[model samples]
Target: MIVTIDGPAGAGKSSAARSLANRLGFRFLDTGAMYRAVVFAALEQGVELTDADALEQVAAQLRIELGDQSVLVNDQDVTRAIRTQAITSATRYAADHPGIRALLVDQQRAAAAGHECVTEGRDQGSVVFPDAECKVFLTASERTRGERRYHDLIARGEQVTLEEVLEKQRERDERDTTRAVGALIQSSDAVVLNTDGMSPDEVVDRLYEIVQQRRVAK
Candidate 1:
């Protein structure tokens, strides 16, 4: 079975998906990290963010490997590097380009083939895996999401204020929902799960139960 978990930043999609995959013995694919890797590579090569053509080229050339908990770009480990604020913001530019998203979508599909996978990203169910057996759209209020992100950055020892984190996440939510290519929206058939007061384990348990129900229905 292929499970898709789609949501905006700090909605617990990544953590839930990873844990869900582990619980079910399925492969976990973090599609966001692929775009982040592209951004990281482009910035490393000094490619201008606004240059869509150059960014698309860089995206096409990237060799990204998604492990259970690590990300590798071009054989170099970037698990922690890509999560920095710099790359996180740069990923918006890379992921917003239509050409870059198209290229990455193809890679994402290829990676899921021949495996029971749990995939998470903004457009996983809407665009990348529309036919997934179980599709979940995780969500939370902006304030809740902002607090989650702020604490996450703090835990990573990044010196950032709550106000800054909130502002950036608000901007990201606007861009993600309004982007022309692969815009983030809840798929019509997806089950929307609010994570405002839910723990990661609770979210995954709910998703796993849904998957079980889906299997029986099938």
Candidate 2:
């Protein structure tokens, strides 16, 4: 079974999905990290973010491996490198490219072909895994999401203010929702989870129950 957890930033999808995967003994696939890996590669290779052709080439040639918490880019461990502000900002460009998205989506599908997976990303339910047995759209209030992001970045020692984080979050939401390809949208059959006041474990438990119900219904 493939369980997709789609959501905007700071909705706790990553943490919840990891927990859900652990509980179910399913593999966890972080699609957003795949895009970030491309961005980090482009930055390291001095490729411009807006150069779609170059970005597509980089995506096609990338050898990315995603472990429990490690991201390897072409035999190099770039787990922490891709999460930097510079790479994070450039990831929007990589993720929005139609060619790059196609390549990565194909890879994501192949990765889950023979194993149960809990995938997390903006377009996991809407685009990458529309036929997934269990699809969940996780969301929270904008203020709450902003605060979560602010604290997370600070914990990572990123020099970002709450106001800046909120502004960037708004911009990302607009772009992600309005983008033409692989847009951030809740699938028609997806169950929406409002995680405004829920803990990560609570969210995971609820999702696990839902997944169990889906499995039985199937």
Candidate 3:
């Protein structure tokens, strides 16, 4: 069973999906991390963000390992490294590259083969896992999402203003919707969850219920 949780940035998809996977005893596929890993590698190697060829080369040589509690890129633990605000802002370069997205999508499929997993990302349901057993689109108001992102970045010691964060969020939202490939979209079949005032645990519990229902229906 593959359950995909798709949504815009800062909508708590990562936290909710991770918990939901743990609750269902399934592997968690953080697709965003896969892309961020590529960006992190490029940054580490001083490769330009727009250099698609160089990005492809870096991705092809990278051994990105996603474990329950850690993400390793070429034997280096980048779990925290990839989640920084810098990676978040620069991820679009790698994500927008058709070649890099193909490589990462292949890795995502390989990771889920013969295993039940909960995958979360902007484009999972629409692009990466279109045939997933259960598809969910989690969303909140733009300000709510922006505020969440602001706090998260602040907690991570990133020096960013709320206004700046919100501005960047809007830009990212536009890019996500308009990207040429792997565009972020809500699948028509997806169940939408408006998480304005919901707690994180509530979100996960609801997702668990949805996935269990999907399993039974299957």
Which prediction has the highest lDDT against the true structure? 3
lDDT of candidate 1?
Answer: 0.90
Task: Please identify model 1 stretches exceeding 4 Å from their true place.
Answer: none
List candidate 2 stretches off by more than 4 Å: none
Error of 1 at 183 (Å): 0.4
TM-score of 1: 0.97
Q: What is the C-alpha RMSD of each candidate to the true structure, in Å?
A: 0.9, 1.0, 0.9
lDDT of 2 by residue, 90-184 (tens): 78898889999899999999988999999999989888888899999999999999998888888889999999988888988988899889889
TM-score of each: 0.97, 0.97, 0.97
Model 2 CA lDDT for position 60 = 92
Misplaced by over 4 Å in model 3 are none
Give me candidate 2's TM-score against the actual structure: 0.97
